[model samples]
Target: MFLIVKSLMLVLMILMVLILVLNLCSMKTFYDKEKNSPFECGFDPKSNSRTPFSLQFFLIAIIFLIFDVEIALLLPIIKTYNMDNITLIITSNFFIIILLLGLIHEWNQGALNWLK
Candidate 1:
């Protein structure tokens, strides 16, 4: 245990010294607008590169992904349906209930409405 601890300490100390040396040797630069701006064919950009994104689209996509993954997880339950295991059936039913509840909650929250 002592040898293991000593080796770990040596490795950590080496890493810390290397980090400190790299930081001390690096060149620091001040921010400049021209340097940061998007370059297009060595000419000034006509418009801003960054644009505002719609949060609604992101939320809907996330919800879709969640349900999609749940569907994938449910596929295996169908394959195991003939196993005649009560515990497995009960657990899968509970999982389906939870997913259904989540879907209902999202629907109530208007996440499924695209026209909003």
Candidate 2:
């Protein structure tokens, strides 16, 4: 315990010293114009950086990400279920039901429709 505490203190001191050195070295002079401007190779930019985005597309992407993550989460539960854990199975089932209900709600609300 003594050695562990000593080592941790040493690590903390080293980190503190490094952070101080970095803070001292990272000061920048006033050069905001160059920092804010886009880099131009020999040619000019064809289009503006800030373009209008479709809300529908964004919604679909968010839904896809949510479901994709849910699928990944479900996979681990599935692997664990093979070990014959009854409580986990019921919990997983409840979780799936909730997901299905959410999906149904979205479907009813026309969120799944592409043209909406």
- lDDT (Cα, tens digit) per residue for candidate 2, span 15-116: 999999998898665688766566654323457645666778788889899988988898788666655677887889998998899899889988889884
Alpha-carbon RMSD, each predicted model? 9.5, 9.2
What is the Cα-based lDDT of residue 13 in candidate 2? 100
**lDDT scores of the candidates, listed in order:** 0.85, 0.81
Where is model 1 poorest over a 10-residue stretch in terms of lDDT?
41-50
**How does model 1 fare in lDDT?**
0.85
Candidate 2 ranges beyond 4 A from true positions: 1-45, 81-85
| Candidate 1 residue 101 C-alpha distance from true site, Å | 0.6
The 10-residue segment with the lowest total lDDT in model 2: 41-50
Task: Show how many residue pairs clash in every candidate, following the order shown.
Answer: 0, 0
Candidate 2 pairs with clashing backbones:
none
TM-score for predicted model 1 compared with the true structure: 0.51
